[model samples]
Target chain A: MILCDIGNTYIHFCDTYKIWKNLPDEINKKELSSDVYYISVNSINEKKLLKAHKNSYNIASIVNLDTPYVGLGIDRKAACLGVENGVIIDAGSAITVDVMDAGNHLGGIILPGLAAYTQAYRSISPALEKRINFGMDFDELPLNTQSAISYGAIKSVVLTIKEIVGDKKAYFTGGDGKFLAKFFEKAIYSEMLVFNGMQISIDKALKKHKEQK
Target chain B: MILCDIGNTYIHFCDTYKIWKNLPDEINKKELSSDVYYISVNSINEKKLLKAHKNSYNIASIVNLDTPYVGLGIDRKAACLGVENGVIIDAGSAITVDVMDAGNHLGGIILPGLAAYTQAYRSISPALEKRINFGMDFDELPLNTQSAISYGAIKSVVLTIKEIVGDKKAYFTGGDGKFLAKFFEKAIYSEMLVFNGMQISIDKALKKHKEQK
Candidate 1:
């Protein structure tokens, strides 16, 4: 089976549960054949999917779940599916938290990412338009404007998350997952958890369809 | 005495305690003379003050308190002075809470105002960019995107203020002060509180300077 998780930045393709960072160039390669291909994407560029499909003839299926096409964020839903009963935090271009109760999903928090929040403030307030890098050792006493903003946003998010989760476990994923993990307790970084969750959702759906027969 | 409070959008002038919605065109008129003129402005042209001074020969004294320009918001300091021992909330372009204990000012909370919060979200997220009119009915469910945004911001501010004040009195001021007054246990809408505060500040400064003799 082949699973493809497409996000805003890059695409991840996995075969037999192992992610292939670099795909082989040649099409019709015998080793690339798989019984099933399940694709979930935020972008509906058919050409990209078709190119990947041509390389594997055993690909008997294809799925597209693009934005506005699929309704909600597929990655968010998938992240929720990956956890049994915990908060799943996705820290990418934006930060979102999806809470899962057993296998059921609950609505979560969505806010601009750290960079986006600071950038938006800078853009709106011409007097405060400046860039500053966020580091692990954020100054307790923020001396500059950028640091003050960065510290406030980061502290607010961290405190908010802590307040919401209480003693519950938290699962961190996405580009800044590892960075945030250090600040949160019971937080484990999982780069492919969202993709894994998508695969699990597809498998469950397929299984339910087969059982109806 | 003439007290003028120049805000982000409006200039409120008062002769004694009676508010004049518009500045008098003929300040030289016999009816317009005042012994003292205290002006507190956030974003008004300096020429208006000069004009006021030129017209009033009885304007024996003049005072102007610079706003948002001095690193801290003028509204904040004014709110601090308006209340003796309570939470002073300024719900205008931005919602700020200044906590005062026994007339001594403590730092406070600063967040986007009701309109600004919704507007910021709408601007950043294309899906939610719509104008919303907020209301007073706390139990009423939000029917649309605008109401939802308004409800969320209002609820957040109310909760934060309640938490901060606990058992103390609460004072509300600003353009949207009336709207927020309904949520607090004891909230009085004082449109000229900031101007009054400026007058008090000036009086205190003068008193202290005289005592140095």
Candidate 2:
């Protein structure tokens, strides 16, 4: 069985969070089992993956349960399916905070990432358009223009996530998962969210295939 | 005595925070005192104000205090003089949090206004870029994508201001001063920060004129 999750920055294939740089030359040469499941934010790679194993390639969206918003991404659907109850935060080009309760999706929010916050500050005020350091040490009282905007934006994201999770367990994923992990009280960083959900899906498909025969 | 402050969005004249839409057709016809004082972000207006009272006018920057960053705005310089100590937050096109202590400008931060924050988010992520609702009811757990980013950005500004103020008094000015004022425990909303500062400078300039005579 093969599992894949495509994001804006990288196409993550399997549980290691390893990026799939290019389509493999041959699907048969991959030497993997026939069953395959995948999800993606970038639609460009969707057709290529499906054509590789047209008969066995299963798009993860059709295997879903309850989703809060209509047309929610399959990647989020898979992430939501990873746990029965908790808050899942996927921090990438965009950050999403979804509250899950016993397989029921209560609600969620999507915010701009750290870079977006800083870029916004620059665009509004031409006087402050110059790029400033975002990696500066965190100071409760910002010492300069760069520190204030950068720290203020970062702290906002942290507080928002904390407010949503409250007493529930929190899960972090995506490119910025590790950075967000350290800030949470009981947050677990996982690369297996999409992959794990795919496992359950492929098993069900296999059972269905046997019954059809 | 005439006091004027030119901002990016509007020009404010008089000892109050009243915005001036245009230069009066005839300054001489107003029949006020000939002593004119002014400062501006737009250089075009600076010349107009200076031309009106070129014979006896005194530009504000000459009457001053210890400014931390060179080329600090006269509006901020006047705000620093409004209080001996504490932080001043001017929330307009750009929200500035300046630290003033014992008549010296320690330092400050410049962040984007509310609109800028939203614009930034839209630029980065096209999928979540659709307009949701920035004015939606506030919730601990956001109900939708729009509410999350908007409320999260707003709350961040509040927390950052609180963090900087600590136990000290926080003075808020600018267009959104009242909105931000509500979020702080010890925050005082004042329209007179810049105007009052200008008053002190004008007074000193007058006293110095007499001394020279």
Highest TM-score among the candidates is held by which one? Answer: 2
Candidate 2: tens digits of C-alpha lDDT, residues B40-81: 665655566566656435466564868646556667778888
Which 10 residues in a row give candidate 2 chain B its minimum summed lDDT? B23-32
lDDT of 2 at A204: 75
In candidate 1, what are the lDDT values of residues B80-160, reduced to their tens digit? 765678877777655566667777665554444556555555544554455545643545433344444444456555665
Per-model DockQ against the true two-chain complex: 0.09, 0.39
Residues A1-213 of candidate 2 have per-residue lDDT tens digits of 557776655555662344343343333426334455577776655555566556445476456758556556677777887789999888876778888998888777776776666677666655555554646676445555566666666766777788778889999987777787788889999867767776666677789889999
lDDT of each: 0.56, 0.69
Q: For model 2, what share of native contacts is present?
A: 0.52
Flag regions of model 1 displaced more than 4 Å. Answer: A1-71, A127-163, A174-189, A205-213, B1-70, B130-169, B176-189, B205-213
Which residue pairs clash in candidate 1? none
Model 1, range A123-212, lDDT digits (tens) per residue?
434434455345824433333445434544565556555644668898887767787778887888887776777677677768878999
Candidate 2: which stretches are off by over 4 Å? Answer: A1-17, A20-38, A41-60, A63-73, A130-135, A198-213, B1-4, B8-17, B20-60, B63-74, B102-106, B130-135
